[model samples]
Target: MTEMNYRTALVTGASSGLGRGLALWFGKKGVKVYAAARRRPQLEALAREARASGANIEPVELDVSEAETTLERIRELDDACGGLDLVVANAGVGGMTDGRNFPWEHAKKVIDVNVTGAVATLSAVLPRMVERNRGHLVGVSSLASCRGLPQNAAYSASKAFLNTFLESLRVDLHGTQVRVTCIKPGFVKTEMTANIQHMMPFLLEAEPAVEFMARAIVRGEDEYGFPWPMDRAVGLAKFVPNVLFDAVASKVVL
Candidate 1:
C-alpha cells in the first residue's frame, strides 16, 4: 500500500460522515488536518476526538454554500499552512424530489451545495497547487451519478456534474505534479443515507467507506467507485435500455 503521509491537509465537511472519518484518518497518520465544516460545535467535537487519539487536527468553520467566503477562506488556509499537501472537496448535500411536484427550492439547494460549493472549494486551492507543482485534490461524488433516478434526480445530477468537473481537472492537469481524484461512493451509513427508505445494496458504515476512499486517494486513482458490488450494478445500469431502466428505477423509493 502506498503510504499517504501528507504534511498538511484540509477536508471540507469534516464535521460528520465520511468527511469526519477522512480527517481523523489523515490526522492519525500525523498529518496536520484542518477540518472545515458549517457546524462549529461539530467541528470542535471532531477536533477533540482527534486530539484524544494524539492526532493533530484543528477545527475550521466553513460553509461551502457561500462561494465567495469559501474561496477566500480556503485560499487563506492554504497559505497559512505554508502549503496544503492534500485537499478534499467533500462538502455536499442530498435531497429527494419528485418530478411531478418539482421542488425547485430543494433542487436548487442540492445544486448549490454539491456542485457550486465543491467548485468553489477546489478553485480556491487549485492555483496554489499548480504554482507549487505538487498537491492532491479529491472530490467525493456518488454512485448515483451513473444514472438519474426518479425522486433523487437533483442529487444525482449534481454528482454527475462533479464527476465531469473532476474528470476535466484530471485531464487538464496531465503531466503536472498535481493530482486529481474523484471518489464515487454507494449508500454509506451516514446522516445523508439515514433517511433513505429503499433498500441500499452493499451498504457500508462511514469508517470502512472512508478507509476505502483513503486508499484510492493515496494511490492517486483518477476515478473510483465502491463498493465493488454497487459499482458493478451501476455500471450495468448505464447500459440498460432507457425504457427498461426507467420502468425499474421509477419503482425505487429513494
Candidate 2:
C-alpha cells in the first residue's frame, strides 16, 4: 500500500473491526494514531499490540453517541496534538428494524451512532482543519445506501444520510487543502456483521477491506464504493424501477 502523507490521525470506533485494522495500518506507517472507542479494555489491548509492533498508538476512551463528550474529547486531542492530519468517522452501529411495528428505539440507536456520531466527529475537527488549510476527513458509509435493504431501514437510511452529507461536505470544501472522502463498503466480516445469517455478496475480510479504504483516503477520492462487482451491482440497482426494486429487496433475508 502507498504511504499516506498524513502524520497524525484520529480514528473513531478504533477498538475493533475495520477501525482497528485501519489504526494498525496507519500506526505501521509511522503515523501517530489516536484510537478512540467506548471499550477501554479493547482499546488498551489494541494499543499494546500496535506499540509492540513499533507503532505509536494511543487509546482514547470515547463514546461517539454522546455528542458533547465526543466533541470535547476530540477537541482536546486536536489541541494536544497541535492538529490531526486525518480524522476518520468510522464509528457506527447496525441492526435490522421491523417496519410492521416500527422499532423506534432501534432506529434511533442506529441513527445516533451511524449518522449523528459521524457528523459530530467531523464537525469537531473541520473548523481547525480548514483554518490550517490541510487535513483529510473520511466517513465509512455502506453499499446499502444505494438502495434500501429489507429489514435494514434504519441502517440503510443512516448510511444514505451519511453519503449525502459527505458529498455536500466534499463540494463545499472544494479547492481547499482539506479533503473529504466517503467510502461505501460492502459486507466485511466483523463483530457488527457476525450475526448476519444471509449470504453476503462480495464479502471481504476486515483487513483487506480496511486496506481498500486506506488507499481511497490517501488518494483523496471524493467518493468510493467497493468491491467493484458489488459496487456495480448496487449502482445498477439504482436504475431499477421502484416497484421491482422493492419486490426484490423485500425478499432479501438480511
Candidate 3:
C-alpha cells in the first residue's frame, strides 16, 4: 500500500526504542500518529518533534499491560481520529532472568508485556479493522523467537508467542482486506539492548531498522525477519538437533 493509504496509525510503546523509532518514521511520512506510551514527558517530546515535521500526533497515555484501560483509551483515540488504518502492537519488556534469579513475577511481567499486551492491543483494534475491512496490523516479534536462548527464557518465549500469534491471525484473516504482518528483528540498537552483555552481530541502528520494517509494513508482508545474516542464522537454528543445540547453547555466556 502507498504511504497515503494510512491516514491514522496507533503505535504502542512509542516512548522509546523501536516503538519511538517507528512512531517518528510514521509521523515523518505524514500519518496521524496515536503515540501510546507510559511516559508523559517522552510522549510530549515526540509530539513536539511531530509538530516540527508538520505531523498530526496525539500522545496517548498507555501501559500496554493495562489491557482494559489501554483498549478503552485506544478506542477513544481512534474515535477522535475518525478511524485507524494501522495499529502497531510494539510494546514489550525483556525482563532478564537467570537460573537462580527466576521469579514468577519477573517472568509474568515479561509475558504480560510481550504477549498479553500485544493481544490486548490487537484485540482492541482488530474488530474495528475487520469491520471497516481495510487496515494493517503489525506485531513486532524478534529473531529470538527462532530458538530458545539459555539467558532469555521469558524474553525468547514471549517473542515466540508473538510470532505464533501473528501468523495465526494472518491465516485466520487470509481472505480479508485487513493485513497482518509480523516483523522479526535480530538486533536493533535501542534502549532495550543498550546494555546487553553479549555479542550482537549485524545490529542495525534504530532508524534504519524501523525504516526497513516500515517498507515491509507498507508492502503488507506476511512475515519479515531482517539483518539477513542474523535472520538466516536464527532461522536455521530451528532445524538444529535439540541435543546438539543444547550442548552448544550451554556455552553461550549471555
Q: What TM-score would each prediction reach against the true structure?
A: 0.97, 0.97, 0.97
Model 1: what TM-score?
0.97
lDDT of 3 at 18: 87
Q: Write the per-residue lDDT of candidate 1 for residues 34-93, one digit (tens) a residue.
A: 999999999999989998999999999998999999999988988798998999999999
Displacement of the residue 204 alpha carbon in candidate 3, Å: 1.3
**Against the unseen true structure, what C-alpha lDDT does each candidate score?**
0.91, 0.92, 0.88
The sequence of per-residue lDDT tens digits that candidate 3 reaches over residues 1-254 is 87789999999999998889888888888898889989999999989988988887889888999888878887887788888999999998885776656878889899888988899898787888889998898999899888889878999999999988888989989899999999998888988898998898998998889899999999988999999898898878999999999999888888
lDDT of 3: 0.88
Full-model lDDT, candidate 2: 0.92
Q: What TM-score would you give candidate 2 relative to the actual structure?
A: 0.97
What tens-digit string does per-residue lDDT give for candidate 2 at 5-70? 788999999999999999999999999999999999999999999989999999999989999999
Clashing pairs for predicted structure model 1, backbone only: none
Residue 251 local lDDT, model 3: 88
Q: By lDDT, highest first, what's the ranking?
A: 2, 1, 3
